[model samples]
Target chain A: MSELWFYILAGMTVAAATGVVMLPNPVHSALSLVATLFLVAIHYASLDAHLVAALQIIVYAGAIMVLFLFVIMLLNLQTDPDESPMNATAAIAAGAALAIAAVLGRVFYAFGTSGAGAELPEGFGTTKALARVLFREHTVAFELTSLLLLVAVVGAVVLAQRDKHDARVEPVEPVEPVETEGQG
Target chain B: MMEPLATPAHYLVLSAIIFCIGALGMVVRRNLIVMFMSVELMLNAANLAFIALANRLGNMDGQTIVFFVMTVAAAEAAIGLAVILALFRNKPTVQADEIGLLKW
Candidate 1:
């Protein structure tokens, strides 16, 4: 039963990831990315990393993707007809690399043993273990992350304001009407 | 106690495939938002590898690092989208080829 569920979640993750790349429209891509993140959270859950799974949902699917949606809506950006297609040379190269890598991966895995041991420590996925490490062992890094978020928020506000200023300035330039031959 | 059909290598290989797909998307797509989403996909793929290795090694540190990575990724998305929004306001387009003011 667990194996069946794992396969299902894995399929969802792969499908969403593909959608994110294949969708032509940016909004659709962002939406599919949200689905992918959610599926990743489920994968984490299936792996018994419950805390990471919960944070994955709350932080990524909840907050970050919402910011993406908000920006997309704010811009009201429509698909431009002038957009170029994906580069053929890059696509071929990437495809070949992926094929080779996949083959190598299969070869490596064929030699790996399924009997490799994995004994998770008690409270491995508990919030207590996470907080203990985060606050005690990684306190400096935790503080730094918060500082980084603060800088990002301020930078976003500054950037948005500058754009608004630019918008106002663009309209201030006087438009000169062109004289037609009939008028002359 | 239970039988394991797939090993850690299986998960690692799967993660690598996903990561390659994300890399391809990042390289081939011209739209800035799509590129950003592809980057996020790559990060998630890395997270998968981290968790798999952590589980195999019987440690929780990788999961803890995944937490930090997710936080940084969120912050990155915020800043990237904000910059994209600003750029769009000036150019009214998000195509990577056209955004070349800084080119020397």
Candidate 2:
């Protein structure tokens, strides 16, 4: 029964992922990618990474995908007629990617399921276990990640903001506020 | 030969397949946003592999690595989208080939 679920989910995931790559419109691609992310979350659950699965749904499918759709709508993009999505160069890239996939598949198939599905430790895949490992063993890296997020926020704001003093437009001078009450 | 059941190797192979698809998307698509989505796909593939390995090894570290990868991915999305928006503002084209600001 579970194997059936895995096969079904895998098929759906590949189809949706293909949609993300093949769809012409960005909106369609974004939606397809959302579906792919959700299916991947199911795969995570099957792997017994329940906490990660929840985070995958919340973070990837929820926040990130919403942001993507929001940007797609904001941009009001239309499919470009001038540029074809696939070209001779793309064909070459596809060939390279296929070669890589073939090599990886062969290597992994040979690697086999020797040590997989081993006896998991207590509280494995739980939030507690994840947190203990994150905070106790890798606390420094955790703090650094927070710092990275902070920098990203600041950098995004800086990059996205319009230039106040553009070469084309003169900078607007700050006007002093009149004290209406005092004048009265 | 007996039909093989789903194993850790199966999951790993799936990850590799997805990663390849993402790479193909990255190069085949001309749209910057679509390319960015491809990058996300690649990240998710890596995350899936991490979970599979963590489960296989019975180690929490792999899961921990995935958590950090998610955080970094979030940051990358924020920064990358901002850069894209900025570039669009300068030259209203999302097609990667059309943007030739650096072309001499």
Candidate 3:
């Protein structure tokens, strides 16, 4: 039962991920990415990662995707007409990606026996179990992660903040390249 | 015989496939936002692997690591999107090739 759902979700995930890549329209791509993330969250649940699954939906599919969509709408980005599907870069990237997939697939398949059928502890992937490890043994790293988030928030605000002097500074007289080229 | 259950190997292989797909998207797409989405895809793939391994090993360490990873991914998205916004402000374009002011 779970195995069947896993295969189904995996197929959907791959399809949605493909949409995120191949869709010409930025909005469409973003929507597809949201779909892919949600599907991945389901995969997390099937793995018994309840806490991570919740975070996957709330943090990833919720907040992060919202940020992406806000950026897309803010920029008013449209479909890229110049990028056709059958380009040299696309072909090369496809080949490279296939190679990487093949290598990784082989390596993971080879890791089949060791730790294959080990029984999970009760509440193995629960928030309580994760929190115990996170707050006890990895406490310093956990605290450092909080600091990192604080810094990132501050940095993002600073980087995206509109310059106050831009109104005065931006309207400079246009310099024609023709005269400059002639002088050079 | 086909395994009746989904093993850690299945999840790990799926993770690899997804990660590769993300890499492909990152390379093939010129739009910075789409590339950023691809990066998120890759991160999610890694998280999937972490969860699968944690479950298989009967340990909480893997899940703990995934928690940290999620935090870091959130931070990365915030900062990266801000940088994208800053770039778009000056250039009015999202295509990566269009913004080459620093490429001497």
Candidate 4:
């Protein structure tokens, strides 16, 4: 775990995260999110969570991001090109959110050292180690997660199913009288 | 001030900053889709904070929780976007401010 790498990766993650928020285009925002997720996955790896790093890429960067992009395309969400996004109300809300974050950061800053200060146990974040805890200790929760995913799939399909928007339609084009060439 | 070495504090501050950015996005953006993306970013920031603490604690549980969070986020995104699509299909717009048919 190199400290230098931690700085680089964490910096990249924050920058990409900012881009996700600040970018005007939803597609760019999603791409920025992809970068942030990748950097964060690398951050997890540096933190010794190799399995998490891999899953982060697969589940988030791979699947979820594609979903976002698909939705953006499906809806054809408008891309805002205006340089300024902050209306008066939005500015106030941004200020309030920043203040809250400042307070939280200050609270954490008061404790300079990591509170836990526990040295890593061997095999702490390996796939095998995590699988044991997940499948054995948290079996019920794991199964529930699968159930949740199933429900989400069914719900998505039910919600997103396309049907006729309206029944009223009048033919605008002049219908040419059908020439009965072969009909008896 | 630039620390020569990376500290948990640095990571925490970064996490906090990103979380706030996500919050700002949520509040400032009119588009429901962008709002949803902001929520995802906030979730990511939370994940970062968790992993940082887990690293400090040397706990496997945090990583495990991250797994669950990822799963839940996936499910949430699926359902939420589907809901958004449904709304758009009915109303033909994604702007949060415009879809106020029931509001009195």
Q: Candidate 4: how large is its RMSD?
A: 6.5
CAPRI-style class, candidate 4: acceptable
Better of 1 and 2 by lDDT: 2
- lDDT string for model 4 (B13-32, tens) is 77788899899888888778
Flag regions of model 3 displaced more than 4 Å. A167-184, B1-5
lDDT of 4 by residue, A4-120 (tens): 777777678778987887788888988998998898787777667789999999999999999999999988877864435767877798789889989988876555373547767
Candidate 2 displacement at residue A83 in angstroms: 4.4
- True lDDT of residue A91, candidate 3: 97
Q: Ten-residue segment with the worst summed lDDT in candidate 2 chain A?
A: A168-177
DockQ, per model, reads 0.45, 0.53, 0.51, 0.48
- When just chain B is superposed on the true chain B, each candidate scores a TM-score of 0.93, 0.93, 0.93, 0.92
Candidate 1 displacement at residue B53 in angstroms: 1.2
Best by DockQ: 2
TM-score each candidate.
Answer: 0.83, 0.90, 0.90, 0.86
The regions of model 4 sitting more than 4 angstroms off are: A1-4, A81-84, A111-116, A164-184, B1-5
Q: Calculate model 4's interface RMSD in Å.
A: 4.0
TM-score of chain A of 4: 0.79
Chain B TM-score of candidate 4 stands at 0.92
Better of 1 and 3 by TM-score: 3
Candidate 4 reaches a DockQ of 0.48
